[model samples]
Target chain A: MTVIRAALLGFGTVGQGVYEAIKTHQKRLQERLGKKVEIAGVLIRDLRKQRSLPKHILVTDNIEDILAIDDLDIIFEAIVGNEPCYTYLNQAIEKGCHIITANKAMFAQFGTKLLEKAKQHRVQVGFEATTAGGVPIIRTIEQLLQVNKIEKVEAILNGTSNFILSEMRKNKLSFPDALQLAQERGYAEADPTNDIEGIDAFYKLMILSELIYGGQPEWRTVEKQGIRTLTSEKVQLAEQKQKRYKQIASLTKKDGKVLASVKPILVNKAHPLYHVEDVDNAIKLETSLIGTFTLQGPGAGKLPTASAMVEDFIYVLEKDKSIKQQGEVVYS
Target chain B: MTVIRAALLGFGTVGQGVYEAIKTHQKRLQERLGKKVEIAGVLIRDLRKQRSLPKHILVTDNIEDILAIDDLDIIFEAIVGNEPCYTYLNQAIEKGCHIITANKAMFAQFGTKLLEKAKQHRVQVGFEATTAGGVPIIRTIEQLLQVNKIEKVEAILNGTSNFILSEMRKNKLSFPDALQLAQERGYAEADPTNDIEGIDAFYKLMILSELIYGGQPEWRTVEKQGIRTLTSEKVQLAEQKQKRYKQIASLTKKDGKVLASVKPILVNKAHPLYHVEDVDNAIKLETSLIGTFTLQGPGAGKLPTASAMVEDFIYVLEKDKSIKQQGEVVYS
Candidate 1:
């Protein structure tokens, strides 16, 4: 039996979710993994924030304190953007510790470097939560790599955008009103630029493209078209035509060049992704082996994203066990 | 680099496709797996039958000839039904050889026994080809098992039944005419009692149930209904209500009791599986962690099913590598 000492970086929505998952499913995870998972510390912005966690759990604001702890086996990070999370993960990887992150922007921009560094140190960098949360899309892609050639990736990746579009259709509301409702419900961020302008989905698409194709998806080459121009008038017109409008994020590799775009598309009954509603995310992979596979699930929430992290935790544990036994060279 | 020596148990459609995949994608697979794969020999029922294969590959009618080859690491069995195939695979497991199979009925009936025997011998047994063709459904379940308790499964499993049902709807054909079309198109067998009567889907569901619930799904307890009773009139009646007839195989755990069934169901455009037409298969998984996930793909064909088996081959190879390194005990 082994005891895994872990830390939570950026105690926000995703961080709290991870801590709660660890607490709720501790027995089951331990039974399945034959190990005890101990949350060594939590890093948050405010020391006075009274989070509802175990009374004895360590809550710290110092990055130096976490770096000084030599016994840390893994780091679960869900910070908003790239900066400090990337830096913290880099340190953890250099220390030969595993890291799981839900930060899509960090992976999209700097995944190659992080993966290379992790491979060099023989530690896993898991980002299942970075894509369609808790849907197992990343691991499915990993298995598909064993015996398939992927052709196209068409997905509904942004839940906030989808929720707004769904509200516009359901309540006959304007795009602005829908966006306001989404923000009120905490689905959309305060700025709402990333969600409404398709930047969030674009980051997720780049990350997925990096995994599918072994290269970076430069943002400049992608076509960004958000749902800002869409209105209830168009939704009514689409309904008259027996179709619905969906915020679609798609990447197709044609003649060795990737055509990446995020836009709202009209879908009819014939389309498999037509039924994906509200905050659900759906990804359709067209491959040479499987023909076409579509996975639809709840995009992301506190527990779902954290569940994805725990999924990564189990994945890294199993991988580390294998690598330690064989002393085999790691591959990203 | 590692070299995998494998043998074919039946040189039929799936077997021929496996050989063709090995031939067509040899370089690509070698690059991906970092290994060399060689088809050492093939087992056939009749030596008199003419087969179009490369000159140096061995073909023998006797199963004993394969067992005599001591260096064989894995067996790829595609023989129909549960007879000599079961016996041959059992022997291979006893010899500590890994096995990959696409035989659904055999697995549905005797998977637990074979998996138990494999565990006793410290060998891997893979059956990704047993259900959902090349969609990677089984592997996805393996990953989801890390963090979720699966609650329910609803799937469209039988491609031939779906094809016939779709043909009836599209062409206004009678059931007999649709079945004839399916048989002519090679979607259904000459004696397609299994496909039309829903036994094929029943077997697939049993296999999936075993994977999800970790227990044997006794066939007698299952509620089976077929597309045999439905007529074109009923199809048209359902069509008027914007609903399509689908051959759905489902298993739900209600109040801790497992309810299993396969039958024709009416699905409207809002249902995720509504657009899964032709030979496509879709499985919707409801779990405690991820909410709902639906996967749609080409159910099975020669190359697709062969791709699934090759996927299993790769899976078992990686698993065997890990086990050999750790010297760990195997489990079903």
Candidate 2:
């Protein structure tokens, strides 16, 4: 059995979840893949801080320790933001190490460049966890787009916004109350500007657009709207009309041009997005060959997000094996 | 590029869709897989029927055409029902030709035996298109179960039943009217007993159980319920209570025992399945690692079902390559 050596870049919520998942499902993973995956190192901001982790696994604050590891096959980047994650990923790629990341901010800006670089280095870079947590939307779309022409990709991509909206509709709470409830429940961050202002969804939309449509729509080109403008009266009115308010992010290809947007729309009770409440996300794809396909799941959470990262890890391992077996094949 | 030769058994809806999908997406498939997949021959019950097929493609009524073909790498059985499809798949396995099928009935009954035979013969058997059409649920579950312990899998597996329920909820139609409307829309067959009686969902549930949970839930063991018992009064009452009715098929591993059932349940406006109306099917899987993950799509349509067949073909091809590369591995 092949043994894949991996390292975690950030030991945060998702990173810790990945560690737990790997430990909890080690035997199952080994049986399924006919290989053992071992974590060689973990990189965090603080080295002195105590963490719920095995002492046998090396923990370091320096990037050089992870980058310099000769046996490290892949890097799992659960770090937030762009600058340092991008730098670490680039270094990993340069070292001919494959990567799986849940960082959407870096991907939204530098995905193409990273993909190109990985291709140049003959390595894999998977970003399935960067989207809808455990929905498998990225891989599903990759499969569908291989056989079908996708016309429109629509999704309730942001769980925080969706939770806030669902709360507003159900409890008739004002935007402030709903946001506060979300933050208190740990669904929203203390500063939830990226989610509430639609920037998070916008970033996801940009990533999906680039992936499915093959190029990013200029961020400013998207007609940005958020759930913040929704009032309690509007929420109540939607409920009265048997509708639920949802923030929808959509990317459509029309005449070879991609149109992307993020907005709060009142979907009727019959619409699928109307029922996806709380910290759940749903994506609906309209393709030429297969018509419509939708996937829903926990959009953001410790386990679900980490499961996605594990999926990407498995994908990278499989791709690595395939490439090794069939040299000079264009995998991407 | 490696070229894989294949044969198609049956010229039914799914078979024709596979043919057309292959022809339409040949370039993309070749680019992605680094191989050209060609249909070497087609097995049909009657060759005199007026069918639109490429003249270069040979159409024959005899199974010998597929069996005798020396270069055929795989056989795609799109034939419905048990006896003939099973016989042909077994023949393919014996002949050392990998098999792909959209025949759920055969798989539901004899998947273990067939997979054992394939393993013995060093071949592959793919049945992705058999359940949930083109949603790729089987593959997703296979991947997830490899890395996580699945707790439960609940799904609106049959599209016909989901359509009837959705129509009943939306248009306030009686069960009979809704079913008739489904037939009129081509979502249901003339003899819709298998679909409406919950047998279809049962079969899919069995497949899921075997594939993910590693054992088949006895067909009779599952408490089966269908939409025929649903009344418009209940639909009205559900709407009055701000709920919707959905036909749900579920399999759960609880306390080391497998529990499986197909029944109609009342879900409030908050449930994702509530909004999955009009021929749409949704599946929710609760796992130890991924929490709750749901997939919704056109469960049974001409193209969607056909897309699944294509996926099965690709899966077979990839697995065949892998098995050939790896001399022998213990089968779990």
Candidate 3:
């Protein structure tokens, strides 16, 4: 059997999830790719920490060590931040490695550069896990754009913020109380500033805008607001009027100008995002030909995020196989 | 510019919609495929009838005349019924012309055979318009099945039935009255037997079953019921209980067996298909990896359905281009 050697750039929650999914769904992976997928190495911050990683995979604190693996076909990056993640993936691309990433922060800023580099290197880039977790919004937009022109997009993009808002409205709890409850339920992080301040959704919304309109609005021009200021009384008042407060990321194109924003809005029952509660995410797209369409799924999760990466892995490998079969150079 | 010659196999509402879509979206087609798509011929059922078709394109009542068009790269089939439609497409496939069809009755019965023949002749088949009109459920299922095992699918697949049911509940009208109103509103046909008797939904359900589970249950084993027998009193009673009567097509795979059915189901407010009223359609799928995901869109319309066919046409032509670039014989 042909073994497709791959490496993990950051072995955190998402990295562990990918490792576990690849281990468990090996049979399915083989059936799809006609090859065995093997995790050759893992890049971790602390090699001395007690971990549950299986044997036969090299654990290293240095990325160069992991990238040095022979014939590495794919690199699954689940790292955070902008600097090192960007630099590391750029190097991986230089090594002719296909990338499947779940790092939205790094991707939102450097995605275009990385894609250009990948094209020059004749490699593929898969970032389906970067936005909306398990919702195949990226692929959906790609397919829809082939024939239709997307006019507007309204979406619930962040799970942590949505869960907090849902808890606040449903329980009549204050923002602090809802944040505490979300943390207790593992829906929010210890330092939920990024999610609470709407930065996370802003990055995702920018990603969607770039995908649809081929470019995003100026960063400072995008009006970004969070749910921290929403009071329980206001939420109650909205509920009394048959409305719900949701963190909505909106993008609209009018007369060739694209406007993007992320904020909490009061939506009535008729709004599709009105009923989207807790960790669920939904994207409502108004297109030129098909009118209105919406897709809803888990916005963030271990398995769901991992599923997106694996799907991307299968996609990248299939594309590679076709390119190789055709004996042609790939420029994707 | 390279001209891609195409033919229309039927000239009903869907055929006209396809023609208009092609004519209006010519720029988009050229951008996506890098070839100018030109309709060389259209097969109409009547010759002397007053029609507004363009003079340059060939119009004929005979299928042979349209099939005889030289270098016809694609055929769009929107004919009703099962016999001549199936035979016409079969002959087109034998001529190595790609096909995009919106005929659910013909497709649901002979789709597998047609696809097999197309494969033998090195042609592609696009049937995204066959089920759920503009929903794109077929493409969604195809992508999801790459990794996840879809355990169950519950969908509102028929728009006319849903529209009539929505009218009966909201207006407290009788079944016949609501159906008549649907016809008057152009939501239902004058002879609404297929839409009211659940056969339309049944055929679409079987199409989904074939795509997901590889084959559908024996037609006799499937339990099919439409909204024809639904009473206004029952609908009102359900509405009082915060429920709505929806024509749901359900398919479940458990214990290595697949069961399929189409029935008027009472759905609560929490159900994804509950608020999917009027001409809207929604499908909720329970998968092994991504959990529960739902897609909602227009269930039926000239523009929406034509959008799907155009999307398929673009897909077929792109695949053809890639295959030609690959210098290989296509088996699909």
Candidate 4:
């Protein structure tokens, strides 16, 4: 058994959760893998921020402090936005260090180039946490593509919007009231534009498109709509008709072209999406071999999202070791 | 690229689907895997029965014929029941052939022994299809165990029972009427004993337990209940309260001991599992790292079940090559 030293690229909620989960579930993780995993460094934007992180682990603002360290085997990028994340990941990949990123924005925008780079470097890049928190959608897609020709992927990829929509339908609350309630419950960020306006869902869908369908549809090609226009009356009307409104991000391939969109759709009571409510996310894949298969789980949160990152770290470690030994042999 | 010669142990629904999936998706599988996978032989119990099948493939009823084929790299056992499936799988393992099985009965009873045998033989056993059709629950559990501590797993593992319950709730039908309707719809078998009595869910739960927790709980130790005793009145009462009755198989570790059960439980509308309706199956796993993660999909059907078996076949092909090059060593 080899012990892999890991580094955190950001110390926000997800990063902190990763650290905490590693400490809390260390015994179980070790038992399962038959090895010890340790966090060697954390790259925070600010070094003086007061938090309950382990004092012994080094915290630094300089990326090179962590990146230049030869002992670090993998990097977990929980950093939001594109600039630093893209730079750090590219550098990490170039350094022959495996990567597990929770940064959907970077992947959504530059995933193709990054994946190509990783492949060129003969390293593994795990982005399971980027799409659906902890639902294992990436691995699921990888497995499904093996046995099925997936024609379409429809998902409620944004939890904040789903949470608000679910509350509006069940509690009969106005959109504003639901949004406010979501904020109070910490389900929605203060700005909430990314989630409520559907940008977050769009980003996730972009990643899914790349992973499942070979490449992403142009950002401009995706028809985007948010939950802001939805009224309480519309939700009630849908419910009266035994339906529910969901913020759906769907990508379909027709005539060798991929069409992607993020919009609010009315799901009848019979559909599985109708049952997906309140910060919960569900993905349905329509495939030639299996017909339709769906997976639902927490689309976002500190612990769940961190769990995904941890899973990605382990997967990357395992896959990276194999890639190192076998060289870059592309599988069919 | 090594071409893995594979054989089908049974030509049932899943076996046929595996055949068709391989034949139809040949180009795609080859493109992804970079290897040519060919079917060397197919084992069937009877050959006189009229069935749609390819002409060039060799078919035989004798297990000895399959076992004697030294060139066969893998055996996909789609046969149901314990007697022949178990015996053939053991033989295949002993003969250094990787096994991909869709039979849950054999796995539920003898997975540990078979897994140990496969380990000793340095071969792999793929059992992804034995759980929830094409939902990828087994792979998800494998990934979860890689990173997180799975504290509990609660699921509606049997689609036939779920379909019956959903029908009873939606149409206010009696249990018997719903069951009859299910039988008519081909969701329920004629006897429906295994599904309706919670035996099927129990078997699946055992498999999940083994995969996630590394061992199976005692079959008799799991507290069991079924939908057979669920009355329409109880269904109506639960619905009136905005709750749904779901046949849930819940597994948890308490006080360092495994606690498992399968029963019909009332789930509030807020719970993610509450929305899974009809014949669909949903699984919600609570882990220390990720709070609650749920996956839902077509639990059972000819194609979905077949899709799972095919996925396992592809996995065995991919992992076998990787494992052969590198030994079965865990990387941190």
* Candidate rank order under TM-score: 3, 1, 2, 4
Tens digits of per-residue lDDT, candidate 2, B149-212, equal: 7888778889888888878877889999998998998889999999998999998889999987
TM-score of each: 0.95, 0.94, 0.96, 0.93
What are the iRMS values of all candidates?
2.8, 3.3, 2.3, 3.1
TM-score of chain A of each: 0.96, 0.96, 0.97, 0.95
lDDT of candidates 1 onward, in order = 0.86, 0.84, 0.88, 0.84
Best by lDDT: 3
Docking class of 3: medium
| Candidate 1 ranges with C-alpha deviation above 4 Å | A328-332, B328-332
- Which regions of candidate 4 are displaced past 4 Å? A1-3, A28-35, A51-56, A328-332, B51-55, B328-332
Best by TM-score: 3
RMSD of 4: 3.0
State the DockQ of every prediction: 0.61, 0.52, 0.60, 0.57
By summed lDDT, the worst window of 10 consecutive residues in model 4 chain B runs over B323-332
Q: What is the TM-score of chain B in candidate 3?
A: 0.96
True contacts kept of 3: 0.66
lDDT accuracy of residue A226 in candidate 4: 89
lDDT of 3 by residue, B149-253 (tens): 899999988889999998898899999899889999998887998988889888988889889998878999999887777899999999999988899899998
In candidate 4 the C-alpha lDDT for residue B129 amounts to: 86
